[model samples]
Target chain A: MLIDTLITGLVAGGTYALVAMGLTIQFGISRIMNLAHGDTIIAACFASFVLFSVFGLSPILALMIVVPVGYVLSDAVYRIIMRPLVARAPNAGALEVDSILVTFGLLFVIQGVLLVAFGGNYTGYAFLNTPVDLFGTIVAANRLLALLLALVFGITLIFVLSRTRWGMTLRAVSIAPENAPLVGIDINRAARTAFALGGALAATAGVVVSMYQTFTATIGVIFTMKALIVVILGGKGSLTGALIGGLLLGLVETFVAAYIDPGLTLAATYAIFLLLLILRPTGFFGQAG
Target chain B: MNTTVAFILAAAALAGLAIAPLFLNAYGIGLLVGMTGYVVLASAWAMFSGPTRYVSLATVAFFGIGAYTVAVLSETLPYPLVLLCACAIGLTVALIVGLSTLRLAGIYFVIFTFGLAELIRQLVTWYEVNVTGTLGRYIFLPFEGIHIYWQLLALAAATLLLSWWINRSRLGLALRAVGDDEVVAAHAGINVSRAKLMLFALSATIITLVGAIQAPRWVYVEPAIVFNPTISFLTLIMALLGGATRLWGPALGAIPLFLLFEWLSANFPNYFSIILGVFFIGIVFFLPQGVLAKIEGLRRPARKAPPENKERSGAA
Candidate 1:
């Protein structure tokens, strides 16, 4: 039973890691909180739903279409909303507050658009509707598939960040944009690219999440909060931190739900979040700013 | 813009609002009551977050607690006492939260407050489900629409007065100093953390009172309804839109936006949110300082002229 729960938790955590990675990129590079991050996820889910239900396309195939769309949409959002705000900001610190307001507005706008496009109703997709025995525990095949895909995407992202010149450029910009410009790195281009990548990752996570569980337009905010918990727990802009944080959060939540009253799960998650903030605000892998 | 003139105009407006219920119909009174509620919320939120530069998303948490307090205790206690209890609860919670989070700056502070609200909402939902066996509590009050309207008006006036007082006080100066640069404020012998905590508690108290006063009008109090994130977003937007930095900015932001919200929700319920979303985006993009500030700037453009530029131009 414990192993089964652990496996389930890990699978759930995989999707969280995907979403948190997107957030970390945006936050690390641009310093924008991107409250609308989960809305992009929701939009992707809706897109996948339409493709599957209307066109008889697989959700995986939908990803090929959705990812590019996500990239463009997020790029547009950055250019239209965030770029102007950043230009007007007096300093990096002020950008945080301004982005919060602007992204919050963006969240509402996206939600409203989704609501107009698709009413407030739960939508889900089932793939590989079979339970497979892993060792002695039973697990859903689709969940395993999601886990595998998340791992692939996560590894690819890590590779791109560590082994690619573009990744180095993004990292340099994130760490020291002022210095990056001194070194001839295009800060604006790096920021725009990060946002686009973040958007794509968000959409991929959304697709996996919709397959795993039901979703609705209203759930975006909750998902955003959860992703934030993962981001903060792992350490503010650390990819490895987000990955580890996501898994740990998943395990804790799963264990709490399994052993204690399920109702306390969210409360417990937030309690740990608060305690972490009080004790070590930098998170496990984060360097104190 | 003189303090004395502003005070007189504020007093005249308050008097007008107080007497409005007599001449207005039920719908008009309802609209005014809702508008006043937003005014109180936005202004109270501005009191702490405006000068301190702390962008708090926890207004809904305090508001929810107050609404729930009234919902649970109104049957057993007097309305006035229940309101006071709500204030006390809000203050206590804010004090605890502010002490822990006030040390963090920028996005950390913002996230902490936002997380605190979400945590409280979830906890309340859990309690309602496991202990209460019901989603919400309903209160039957003996007050009419006019009484509620008067109470709302009084709350609005009180919030406005408190905000005005804060803007004029030493605390406000300390808060502004903290907002401008916390280290500088600390170096200047101001107890920065204490000022933040006090302002947070005070803001929470006023917001709680507004929630308590407005609870009975709804008759039904649910965690989901009272603790709705929309309240936080709307209050913040209204305060920002009207000019969060100014004393009367929130009121200025609330009246028009609330009216538009009411009109759209009533007439085009489906498209209302879309319009609001677009409006918010427009405001953020075009007028980050808020509508009132924009108007004020337009009205007195010469006030913003750089002294150096003026002297240089004169010499040229």
Candidate 2:
């Protein structure tokens, strides 16, 4: 039972890390909290569901369509909503508050649109239903597959962020936006790229989630909050911090569910989050303000 | 606007509302009750968030605690006493939370409050599950619609008066200074943390009273219902939509917003959320300063022409 719980917790944490990566990058670049990030994931899940149920396409195949669509949609949201707020704000602090409110508005808008389109039904795909044995513990094949994909994407993100010129530009923009422009890097283009990449990563996580879990339209906000907790716990802008934070949260939640009442899991998660905020606001890997 | 004139006008409006239920039917009274609740919530929210510049998403936490306190105490105590208990409970919890969280800046403060709210909500749910063996409790209150309406009106009036007083007080100046720049305020001999904590407790007290007043109308007290995120979002949106910076902004925003919500919910229930979502986004993008601010802006040049002399003198 302990081994199974450990495996399950690690896998869940891996998926959470995948989602947190997108939030970390977006926040690092634009300082927008992106409350709509989870809704974008929900949108991708719905896309995969529609494609699978109607056209008999696999969720993996649906990703090719969802990622680019997510990119465009997120970019449009940033341009139409966020850009105006940023332009109006007098300083970075004001911009942060404005962005949070604007993103919250975007969250409701996305959820409303999804509700209109899909109603409030829980949807999932029944793929890879076989059980697999891993070191004396039995697990679902789809969960393992989801974890594998999350890891692949997560590693690729780290690689790209560290090794590519585009990644360097993004890092520069995040660290010193004023200096990035002085160094001839087009800050706007880098920010736009960050949004697109963040959207794609969110969509990828969504596809993995849809393959393994059932979800409804309203569930998006909870996931967004959870992802935010992971990001904050891991240290806001650090990819490595996101990984560690996700794992810690997942383990705590899984253990609480196993030992205590399942209903108390969320409560326990939030309690830990609050304690962490009060005691160590910088999180595990974040720089002290 | 003269402070004394605004106070009188607000009192007169409250008096008019107090007598309105005598002629109106049950549906109108019910609508007025909801509007009054929003007025209290929005104004109290503006009181704290406006001057401190700390955007809190914890309204639901105090509100839920107040509601549950009423549910548990209404059977044993008189209604007025129960309301006071709710305020006490809210103040105690706010004091504890504020002390721990008041030192964080901006986004960190916002997230911590939000987390605290979610924590309280979950804890309440857990208690209900383990202790009560049911999701919620039903409370019985012996009050008519008019009586409840009057109580709500009184609460709303008190909130408005408190807001007006705060806007004109030395505390308000210190709070505004803290909002503008905390370090500067600290250097200028203001106890910034104490000011923030006091306002936080005061805001929570008002919100809790509003919840206690409205709890009987709900009939049932559930963690999910009382601690609903929608309440927090609505209060925040209404306050911002009316211009939180202004004393009367929340009332101006709440009346139209409550009416529109009523109309939309009754007519096109499925599309109501979508419309509201669109409205929220539109307001954020186009009317961030709120309707009151926009109106004030149009008349600012005329007002400022005379103020230029005062500004030069102040600068000199």
Runs of candidate 1 exceeding 4 Å displacement? B303-316
B-chain TM-score for every candidate: 0.92, 0.91
Identify the CAPRI category of the predicted complex in candidate 2. acceptable
Candidate 2 on A58-148: residue-level lDDT in tens? 8888888888888888788778777766666666677777777777777777888888888999888798889999989999998899888
Model 1, B1-316: lDDT tens per residue? 6979988987897788789889989998888888988999999999988887788998999999998899989999987789889988999999888887787765666776776777887788888798878878998989777888788888888877877788789998988888777778889999988998999999999998888888888898888888888889889989989888887789889999898888888899977667876787787777767777677668888786332111111000
The DockQ leader among the candidates is 1
Query: Highest TM-score: which candidate?
Result: 1
| Residue pairs with clashing backbones, model 1 | none
Summarize candidate 1's per-residue lDDT along A175-224 as a digit string, tens digits: 88889999899898889989888999999998888777888887888778
lDDT for each candidate structure: 0.84, 0.82
